[model samples]
Target: MSYKVIVNATLAKFSASHFLKEPFQCSRLHGHNYYISVEVEASLDENYIVVDFIELKEKIKIIAQSLDHRVLIPELSSDLAISETSESIEVVTNTNKRYVFPKIDVILLPLPATTSELLAKFVHDKIKEIYPNKRITIKLEETKNTIAVYKSN
Candidate 1:
């Protein structure tokens, strides 16, 4: 039998997007209370039927600590209109206006836009870095009613 674990991490963020050929990748600037759920396939330890929630929380925390609250900039983000400085992030829109974000904050660079599907995959990758040879699944929820999952091969 396999055991599963779920961990909660407090998260906040900001971003923008617009579809192809449009201009921006997202509709407009937006943020969400992002939650990450990681599922590991392993037998329970000698004392329990699954890994301890605290241990799992620590594992998940390593990744979450870097992204808890800040701007999420997709490397695929359009326009190449971003500047990183010691104080703030300067985001210049396609139209030439700029938005600044405080530094010493979280800024995640995802390969894809901050959609649930892609975010799950991104989280899966981070988890893999911790367990190089083990299989795992990552689930991300933008809202309680919605979620996306990525299962490793």
Candidate 2:
């Protein structure tokens, strides 16, 4: 039989800034208090356990802390022209909108965009690395009513 465990969004959250490529309002830089919830499914171990709650929460905490209070930049976006200096990173969209941010305040993700769907996959992959044999699901909430989900089988 298989068992499942979850780390709810309420207990695992982070604040970060990001922008999307389309959807006019989202194209402008903004920040959100993002929440991430994780669900892991796997057969119980010999000890009749799926996973330790504390351990899973700690791992999620680490990933959240890394993204907290940072500007997420998509390094793989063809729609963006990015440049960096010792102190700052500059970005310009294909539409010619420009932005400059401090290097220390940014996180360059290897993604085409920082949309919630991609971010959910990003988080799913991170957790998958830690639990290679288990099924993982990540629910990423960008706002109160908007959420994106990613699953790894």
TM-score of each: 0.70, 0.96
> Which predicted model would earn the best TM-score?
2
* Candidate 2 lDDT tens digits, 32-52: 999999999999988788888
Q: Least lDDT summed over 10 consecutive residues: which range in candidate 1? A: 12-21
lDDT of each: 0.64, 0.93
Clashes of each: 5, 0
Q: Model 1, which residues run further than 4 Å from truth?
A: 1-26, 43-53, 94-97
Q: What TM-score, to 2 decimals, does candidate 2 have? A: 0.96
Off by over 4 Å in 2: none
Q: What's every prediction's RMSD, in angstroms?
A: 4.2, 1.0
Clashing pairs in 2: none
